[model samples]
Target: MAMSNAGNDYPLSEVPPEARKGLASLAMVLLGFTFFTATMFAGGKLGVAFGFADLLLVIALGNLLLGLYAAALGHIACRSGLNSVLMGRFAFGERGSKLCDLILGFTQIGWYAWGTATAAVVLGKYFGLEQGAVLALMAVFGLGFCATAYIGYRGLEILSWIAVPAMALLLILSMSVTTAKAGGLAGLLAIQPSSSLDLSTAITLVFGTFVSGATQATNWTRFARSTRVAVLASLIGFFIGNGLMVLIGAYGAIVYQQPDVVEVLMLQGFATAALAMLLLNIWSTQDNTIYNFAVAGCNLVRTDRRKTVTLAGALIGTALAVLGMYDLLVPYLVLLGTVIPPIGGVIVADFWLRHRGRYPLLAEARLPHYNWPGLAAYGLGTIAAFGSPWVAPLVGIGVAALAYGVFNGLTRGRTTAPASL
Candidate 1:
C-alpha cells in the first residue's frame, strides 16, 4: 500500500518528506515532553530533601545523561523516519517488536492516567471540589486531550506552543514570590536541607522523572529534517525544560516548604495562576501521553487506527484515574524508568553498530519474527536493572548494549538487504 501521514501517524512506514519538520517544531514538541507534571513532582522531592547546590548538580547530571539517551534514539528515528515501535521491528524483529509496542503502549497509558488524576487532585484541592466532581474533571481533561491527539502531531505542536510558555511563566512567578518572601537565593543556599537524599537515589529519581518518555522520543524526533535537529531537540527538552521544572520545585521547597507547584502558587496568592498552570502543565504531558499510547497501539494492532486508539486510550486512562489508579500507577512509571531505557540501548547499538547510519525501507525489508539476540540482551538488561541497587538504568543500558554488540559481532551482523545495496 502507498503510504502517507494521512490517518496512519506513520506507524508502519517512514514519515514522508513532505511531512518532515524542522528544528524549531521538533524542539517545541520535545520541549512539551519535559513539561510533564511528574518532573515537577520529582523536583519537589529533590527540593525538600537536598540542599539547592546538591540538587542542581544531580538534576543537571541526570538530565544530561537522559539527553544523550534520547538523542541517540532520536538520531536513529530521523535517519530511519521510524518511531520506536517500528524501529523495534528491525532490532527486536517483526512479531517480537510487539513486545516493545506493549511495553511502550502500556507505560504511556499509565502516564496518561497519572497526569489526569494528578490534575484532577490538584484542581479538586484548589476548588474545594471532591469525589465525583474530581472524576468528572478527569473525564473532561481526558476527553479534551483525546481531541488534541485525535488531530495527531499537529495538535500536539499547537498545544505545546501555548502551554509551555504559560507554564514556564507561572513556575517563574511562584519561584520569584517564594524566594522573595523566604529571603533570597543566598538564603536558600545557606539554609540546610531538612534531611538528605542519598546521591544514588536522588539521581535515580532524576532519571525516573522522564526516563520512560525519553525512550519514545522518536515519536517526536522522527519528524526532524536531519539527525542534528533530532539530537538538538532532545537536549533542549531534557536539559533546559526538565531542569527548569526541577528548579521550580527546589526553589519552592526550600523557601516555602511546599513542593507541590499548584500549592506553591496558591500560597503565593496566585490562585488564578495556579489553576491555569496546573491545567496547562498537566495538559501538556497528558496530551503527549495519549498521543504516544495511540502511536504504539497503532503499531501493536497492525492498523492505522491512531485516532481511534487515541480515544480508546484516553477513555481507559480516564476510567483508571477516576478509580484511583494513579496512586498505584506511579510506581510503574518509576519501574519503567529503569526498564524501558534498555530498549533504547539495544536500538542505539543496533543502529550505530549494525546498520552504520542507514536501514532498508521498513516495508520492503525482509525481517525476522524476533531478533533473538536483541531480545536476549533486553531481558538481561531488565534483570540487571532490577538486580542492581545503583544506577539501574545506566547498568541496564551498558549490559544490553554489550550483549547486543557481542551477539551481532558473533553473527557477522546480518541484515535483510543485499550486501552491495
Candidate 2:
C-alpha cells in the first residue's frame, strides 16, 4: 500500500533528517505534555499519606525511574526516526502491528475522554453551570482541544511554547502560597499524615500515573536531532516537569488538604489564575493525547488521513466523556499501568536485541504477518505484571524483555529474517 504523508505527520514512514528538531523545542513540547493535572492528583494522594520528607523521596525515585524508561525509548525513537507505532511494524510485524495500534490508540482516546470530561466538569463547577451546560461544554471542549493536534507537530510545538511557561508560573505561585500558609518548611515537617500507605504503593502510584504517556512520548522524541537531545528532553519532561507537578500537588494536599492545583489556587483567592491554569493544563495535554490517537489510528488502518481520524477520535472521546469518563479515572489508570509498559518493553527488546539497534526503513522492509515471539512475550509480561504484588509497570517491562530474549533465541534459524524491498 502506498502511504501518504500529507498532513499525516509521517505516520507510516521514518521522519526525514531535515525535519529533526533541537533539544529546546523537543524538551519544551514534552514538558508541556507532562505538566498534567492527573499527575498532580496522584501526587496529592501520596502527599496525604506520607510525610513531606518521605513524599519527596518517593517523588524523586518514581520520577527518576519514569524518566529513565522514557529516555531509553526516546533513544530508540531518535535513532529510528519513527514513533512506537511505526516501530511496532518491525517488532510485531506487518499485520501483527495492528495489535499495537489498537492498544496504543485505545489508551490515547481514553486519555482524551478523561481530559475532556475533566475540563467540562471542572469548568462547569467553577462557573456554576447546570448539568446540561456541563455536557455541552464537554462537547465544545472535546472538539476544540483537538485543534492543535489536527495541525500536527508544528501545532503541538507552538501551543507548548506558550502553555509551558504560563503553567510553570501558575504552579510556582500556588506552591509559594501553600508554603506561606503552612508556615514554611518547618511547619510542613510538623504536619502528620491522616492516611497510611506503604512506600512501594506510593512509588507505584507516582510511576504508574504517567507510564502510558512516557511510553507514547516517542511520538515527539523521534523528532530529536540527536540521541542526547532525546534522552535529555525525556528526563527534563518526565523527571523535572512531572516532578514539579507531583510536588505542587503534594504541597497543596499537605497545606489545604486538596490535591488539585486549580482548587488550591481557588482556595488561595486566585480564582482567575485557577481558571487560566485549568485551561492551559488540560489543553496542552489534551492536544498531545489526541495527536497520539491520530498517529496510531493512521497506522491501524494503513491510511494517511490523520486529520480525519483526529476528528473522528475527538467525537468518540466526546461521547465517552459525556458518558462519565471522569468517574472512571482510577480504574482506567490501573488498566493503563498494567497493559502499556510491556509494549514498550517488547519494542525496546526487538530494536536492540533482535535488530541489533538498527531497523531498515519501513517503506523498504518486507516483514512477516505475525511475530509470535513478540506477541507471546507481551502476553507473558502482562500476566506477570498483573499478578505481581510489587510495582507492576517495572515487572511488566523486565519480564517482557527477558521473555522476548528467550523466545527470540529459541526461534532463531527456524524462522526467516525480514527481507528488504
Candidate 3:
C-alpha cells in the first residue's frame, strides 16, 4: 500500500530524522497533555484519605513509577520514530495489531467524551445555563477541541506553548491561595485526614489515573530529536507535570475541602480565572486525547487521513458526551488503569528482546498476520493485573514483559538446531 506523508506527522510511517523536534516543542506539548482535570480529581480523593506527608509520598512514588515507564517507552519511540500503534505492528503482528488499535482508540475516545462533557457541564453551572444550553455547549466544545489535533503535531505544539504557561500560572495562583487559607506549611501539616484509605490504594489511584495517557505518549515522543530529549520530556511531563496536578488537588482538598481546581479558584474569588483555567486545562488534554484516537483510528483502518479521522472522532465523542459520558469517569478510569499498561509492556518487550532494540522500517518490512507470543503474553498480563490487589498498572506491565520474554525464549529454543540445542 502506498503511504502518504502529506501532513508530515507521518501517522502510518516512520518520523524521519529531518522531521525530528527539539526539547521545548516536545516537552511543552507533553506537559499540556498531562495537565488533565480528571487526574486532579483523582488526587483530591487521595488528599482527603491520607495525611499531608503521606499524600506527598504517594504522589511522589506514583509519579516516579509513571515517569520511569514513560521514559523507557519514549526512548524506544525516539530511536525507532514510531508510536505505540505503529510499533504494535511488530509486537502483535499486522492483523493482530488491530487489537491494540481498538483498545487504545476506544480509550482515547472515551477520554475525549469525558473531557467534552466536563467542559460543558462546568461552564453551564458556572454561568447558570439550562440543560439545553449545556448540551449545545458540549457539541460546540467537542468540535472546537479537535481543531488543533486536526492540524496535527504542529497545531498541538502551538496550543501547548500557549496553554502550558497559562495553566501553570493559574495552578500556582490557586495553590498560593490555598496555602494562605491553610495558614502556611505548619498548618497544612497539622491538618488531619478526613477519611481513611490504604497506602496501596492511594498509590494505585495516583498511578492509574494517567497510565493510559502515558502509555500512548509515544505519539508525540516519536518526534523527539534524540533519545535523551524523549526520555527527559517524558519524565518532565509524567513526573513534574502530573505531580503538580496531584499536589494541587490534594492541597485544595485539605484546606478548602474542595478537590476541583476551578472551585478552589472560585472560593479564592478568582471566578474569571476559574473559567479560564477550566477551558485551558480541558482544551489542552481534549485535543491530545482526540489526536490519540485519530492516530489509532488511522492504524485501525490503515489510512493516512488522520485529519478526517480526527473530525469523525470528534463527532463520535461529542455524541457520547451528550449521551452522558460524564457520569462514567470513575469506572472508565478504573478500566483504563487495568487494561492499557499491558500494551506498552508488550511493545517494550518486542523492541528490546525480540528485535534487539531496533525495528525494521514499517514500510519495507513484511509482517505476519499474528504473533501468538505477544498476544498470549498480553492475555496473561491482563489477567494478572485484573486479579492482583497491588498497583494494577505496574503489575500489568511487569507480567506482560516477563511473559513475552519467556514466550520468546521458548520459541527461540524450539527454532534452534538440534545439535546446538
For candidate 2, what is the TM-score? Answer: 0.96
**Candidate 2: count of backbone clashes, pairs at least 3 residues apart or interchain:** 0
Candidate lDDT (C-alpha), each: 0.83, 0.88, 0.89
| Model 1 ranges with Cα > 4 A deviation | 1-4, 418-421
TM-score of each: 0.95, 0.96, 0.96
**TM-score of candidate 3 on Cα atoms, chains taken together:** 0.96
Ranking by lDDT: 3, 2, 1
**lDDT by residue (tens digit), candidate 1, 35-69:** 87667777878887877778889889988888888
After TM-score superposition, the amount by which residue 152's alpha carbon in candidate 3 deviates from its true location, in angstroms, is 0.7
Candidate 2: stretches off by over 4 Å? 1-6, 413-421
* Range of the 10 consecutive residues with the lowest summed lDDT in candidate 1: 412-421
- Residues 243-264, candidate 2, lDDT per residue (tens digit)? 9999998898889989988888
Error of 2 at 348 (Å): 0.7
